[model samples]
Target chain A: MTVTRSKAASIRAARRDRWAQRLVQCGLHAGLMAWGALAVYPLVWVLLTSLKYTRELYADPFGLPKHWKWSNYQEAWVYAKMGTYFLNSVLLTVGSLILVLFLASTAAFALARFEFRLKGLVWGYILFGFLIPHSILLVPLAIFTRQIGLYNRLGGLALVYAAVGIPWNVFFLRAFMETIPKELEEAAIMDGAGMWSVFWRVILPLSQPALATMATFHILSAWSEYILALVLTGTTVSRTLPVGISLLEGHFTSNEPGVAAGMAITIVPVVLAFAFLQRYVIKGITAGALKG
Target chain B: MRRGRKRGTSWYGSPVGIFLFVFPAVGVYTALMLYPSLLSLYYSVLEWEGGPISAAPFVGLANFRQMLSDPIVPLALLNNGRRLFLDWAFMLPVALTLAFVLSRLRRGASVYRFLFYIPVILPATTMALLWRFILSGNDYGVLNSLLRMVGRGEWVRPWLSGDGYVQWSTSFPASWQHVGFYMVIFLAALVGIPEEYYEAASIDGASGWQQLLHVTLPNIRGVYVSCMILTLQGALGAFIYPLLMTKGGPMHLSETLISYSLYLLWQKKTWGYGSAVATLSFLLGIIAVALVWRFGRQRESALYR
Candidate 1:
């Protein structure tokens, strides 16, 4: 009878432990879900609010719009001239990506393959660019751009963007290039390929993944940059989406829904890009951070 | 001998090839980034408006002296310090907790990770604008509406309009945006831990919390230090959220060093003073980086020993 009683006690204890574990699991799920909700709530609110008429927004800030006014986006795009700004931003991002990839890859290739005097010095010099804040350079860069007649031009802005991206690009790409075996290049060399052709054909093809990652990073950063764009470009012709949207906010201060629509327009492309390339973006960021 | 000579003449060893490959990047980077940085140092000592560089008169150490005496400098530095403190206090533990929880999950972890990281991908301007609306000072604000719904209406105050709450209000969005970033970092570190460590701990009759303490945290000490350094750098150079939300307003209460420098240059048009402020900010960033490096190295050594 005592043995049977002890067996029953052990069963009860096991059941209690199971219950406790379930409770903890539930609590963990709830906490994580709550955090996820907080992360997404503001974005959803803005998106929905952008769809509401002014009266509906004031009536219920948190509610779904009674009538989904997609025209808000139309107005923001056409009437606010965000369309033009959007084009400029695309141009700058693409232009800068091209320039950065071409220059940084070539430079990284040379740095990775060659042994020359001043190699460490040059590497250190370029790496120092990582530490200098953009704010500190804002004044002189503005002056330099103006002096060089590149101020208020999209091409010039793209050049600045490329310059800004090079240090990190070179740093990351050099590391990537070093991992490519010398035998691959040597085989190409045996086939009578010059250094340029080897890099262009052999090395560049091999570094596609790293190049894509860096390109995405450049696109995201250049697209979202504000202060530099603000300082450098003074007019609508050259102004990027972020600066234009900021101006929209100022111009239509009381028109909350209109401004929110503009914000939504600015964010959608980024969101779409992120959705498709989430893995690459996350990998690039982690690799960069860890390497640094 | 002929093959060796041919190999030597190839592009990899050729000086012209090196020049062609490397000079463009080096030249542009120097002309744009490095040169301007040095020019900023030079400009900090000169009494120049936004005019011809040659026209400006050099006032050696005057801008620095003026900056030392400027009352706004202290306030801005203090605000940045407060932001760094708040971010470390709030973001680190919350992110760690979320990361830990996600790491423990068996399935759908990627979905949770994606959801959590949504905020990180959104542009800072959009985030600031959205947050501005949510924290709008009036009755129509989201927070106020929620408070009223929960019968806590009395607790609601003008979040961004008043001096008392403006700093916290401006800092919140930055911390919110970056929690996912640091969460991912910590998650990566957590995922990197070998499975055997946990198995050993469990075999020793260690509870989940005990395993975390003994196995997880110690293994991730290096990553923790990196996260801390990144957080510090981010806090020091924070510009966008404050620029959009407060514009360093409520009588300069929310001003950070970056925004303050921008204000001095853009609004006030005090080039030398602004450059001086920028130089000082740069100095602070260097100092912070050095301190973090030393602290991390010391802790790492202590742990190894």
Candidate 2:
């Protein structure tokens, strides 16, 4: 092959190409960084806005506040009744979490291990539960809870959250349990352990990682859940933070800062949870997507 | 003698143990989920007010007839269609591109990954609330304020007001919340594709865009299809956005089926009609999911192409 250009010229052209590639890379990364900033900007904006007074917020909605009005939090908590809503949300989330873990874990162990006549039917029951979209249940469940005397009660709401969680949790935990080696259960049984003892000591202990993953997963969902919480619960006393905040638009619409404070109260806990336990929550959600 | 494969040495295999182990989960699920969901069909055929459903007058298909005749019905359905279209059109390509770009970048992918997912983990109400203020009809709104700051104040307008804009305003908030989610999913799928695929593509003289078209997209088809199904569920069932941001609007222009059905029950107290809406909407969801499942599944492998 013959050289088409002088050596110095060819080298200079190669350097120009490399420089162009670097420029293109820079352009792409800059666009991506802008996208990331845009995505996160809302949460930061609302939180910052929450700390501004109404007049100050109106004056410069995009700028940092000259005087941080922490009273907005107090106003949202007390006047908007977000304090009660926060407590209700906490109670309901914790209550439902406990219910889901116990019921689902045991059921998962049985479905994973034992052979029974009704096992397929039982699994199909939970499986068929998926066939119906969740919104379909809002009507009857609202009425059924009332008829059965559990309506407007946080415990009842917890029970409903537990029920909604069962199908997925059982599916997830059962799959995880099936992957556990049979040797552990065999050793427990040979030690004269009954099914109860076996599950409590051997299987349950072994399933801690799955349980914790699911627990964090459940907290994230049940905490933020809105429609059902709105439907089932009655007044502000029974209302969760989300439903309460949704209604805050009606009552506190004029007080933008106060509303922002309510929004902050609603978001901060779950964001904090996601911050620390993201590994489990992200994996749980991704794995949870598999059933769909 | 061979031990029975169907039978076990454990007490869990026994009838009593099975009942004890399964009863709570089954009972709770049946009572709260299964029973109520299926009961909606029955409730759809009856008329109930504020009292117990037992005493409600049974109206055979009257609610269904009313729903078909309701004007809000068609509008709501159309809005849902718009949302579903936007979810697909906006989210899939954008998320795919973002995921692809992040995968190619030499630095800061980890921070971007975490930052991208923040909106997704927030409650739908929280997103709706943040966006509601951002798109407010006044100069104080974040969007308008930013616009004015940049001397584009003339471009600022109420995004969620009762009009065409009400439906579109939610598009960004919805996509913002989910783009990260689908990004992560695609990113995971991209990671699984062997590096040799790209190496071979580069050897074939494919540019980056060409590699994305020929190598990246084809590889992530399964994830993309599943993401389609997830997006379908999300779009069709979106409630909080409409419920908070627009409240189904000044003229009920932004109502989705789920939100409208909810408005019927909670506000109108037309239990039977609400049930009918919920039932039909859910049926639509099932049919949509099935259709996507059938159509999204690729019978021919992209590898051969």
Candidate 3:
């Protein structure tokens, strides 16, 4: 009788433990979902608010719009000049991506493959970029550019972006290139392929993953860059989206829905790019944190 | 560079080739980043209004004197300090714990990561604008609306426009987006711990909490140090939030050092004093980083011992 009683008690205890385990699991998942809501709700509210008439915006902050006011987007794009800002940002992103990849990748390839005097000096020089606070650098850069007649031009801004990225991009790609075996480059040399051919044919093709990572990263930074654009670009002729969208604040407080639409416009491309390039971006962040 | 032309040497390995490869990058970097930064050192000690044509008379520490006497300089510095403390107190612990738990998950981790990381991708401008709307003074403001619905109308105040609330209100959005950023960093660090460590701990009859204390936290010390540096830089370089949200006002209450320097540079055209302020702010950044490094290295040795 004692043996039977002990077995029954053990079974009950085991059941209770399982119940507690299940409860803990449920709580964990619930907490995760709640945080997820916190992350997503503001973005959703902005989207919903953009579709409302300005009157309905204050009347119902959380509810769905009575009418999906597509005109908010139309007016923001046409009247609010987000279209112009959007184009400028696109031009800047593409232009800088090309310049950055070429400059960073070549410098990285040479630094990785060649032994030369001043290599350490070169590395230290570029690394010094990180030491200067960005705000301090801006005033001087603005003065330099203005003297040269490039101050307010998108082309000049693109050059600045390319240069700003050189420090980290070169560091990252050089590290990546070092991992790529030296044997491949020697084989290409044996085939009588000259330096440019080897770099173009072997190194560049091999470094595609790192290049893609930097290209996306550059795009993100250039697209979102503000203070530089604010200090440098004096007019709508060259203003990027972030700076342009912000300029609306002083003049268009009544056009809150229009600004919401403008915000939506600014974000859509980022969301789209992020969706497609999510894997590379995640890899970029990990590498950036670990290696940088 | 002529070293490349030696017999049996690879063309790319030649000195000329190396110079060619590195030149454009180095030149552009020097022109844009390094040269400008060096020029700030010169300008900080000069009396000049910013155009090329303006005479830059050497001021020799006069701007620094003014910086010492300025009231807003300390206020701006304190604002950055408050931000750093708030982030460490709230964001870092939450991010670290979330990353730790998510690292242990066998399923649905990707979904949560995706959800959490979406905010990190948004621009500072978008975040500022979104939060401004959410925290607006009027009926459209989400927080105030909620308070009214709960019969606590007395609690509602103009978040950005009110007398004392501007600083915290601007800080809220800047801090909000960073949770995902630090989480991703910590998550990467956490995911990198070898399964063997956990197995060994379990073999020794260690519980999960014990393993976390003894094994997990020690492993991510390097990443945490990196996070600290990034956090400090983020705090000091905070410009967009106060600029867009509050315009550093009702009366310059929310000004960061950077925004205040921008005002001195543009609106007031005190270029010399502004350069001085900017230079000092950067010096503070370097000193702050050095302190973090000093403590980080000290703790690292203690951990090993």
By DockQ, the best candidate is 3
Q: After superposition, how far is residue A100 of candidate 1 from its true place, in Å?
A: 1.1
Candidate 1 lDDT, A1-292, residue by residue in tens: 9999999999999999999888888888888888899888887887998999988888888889999998888888888988899999899989999999998999999999889878899899999998889999899989899999999999999999999899999999999999999999989778777777788888999999899889877877888998889999999899999999888876676777888888888888887877787787778767755653
Two-way TM-score contest, 1 vs 2, winner: 1
**Model 2 lDDT tens row, B1-305:** 22222333555469888788899999999999988887888988888866766798999989888877899999888878887787788888888888888888878887888888888888898788778778888666778788888999788777878487888786557766888888888777777679999999999999988998888877777777788888888777877788888878868888889889888888989888888888878888889889988876643353455
Correct interface contacts retained, every candidate: 0.56, 0.58, 0.61
Residue lDDT tens for model 1, B1-305: 12223453355567777887899999999999999999999989999777776898999999989977888889888888877887789998888889899998867788888889888878888888777777878867878888888999898888988877988888878987889888888888888789999999999999988998999999888888888888888888987887898898878888899999999999988898899899988888889888998989898899899
Alpha-carbon runs more than 4 Å astray in model 1: A1-23, A289-292, B1-9
- In candidate 2, which residue pairs clash? none
DockQ of 2: 0.46
Which residue runs of candidate 3 sit more than 4 Å off their true CA positions?
A1-19, B1-10, B50-54
Q: Give per-residue CA lDDT, model 2, range A1-292, as digits (tens).
A: 2365677788999999999989988998899889989878888888888998888888877789889999999999998899999999999999999999999999999999889897899998887766667788887887789989999999999999999999889988999999899999888666666778777888899999899899988998998998889889888768999899888977786788888899999999998998888788667656644433
Full candidate order by DockQ, most accurate first: 3, 1, 2
Q: Model 1, B293: alpha-carbon shift in Å?
A: 0.5
Complex DockQ per candidate: 0.52, 0.46, 0.54
CAPRI-style docking class of model 2 based on DockQ: acceptable
Better of 2 and 3 by DockQ: 3
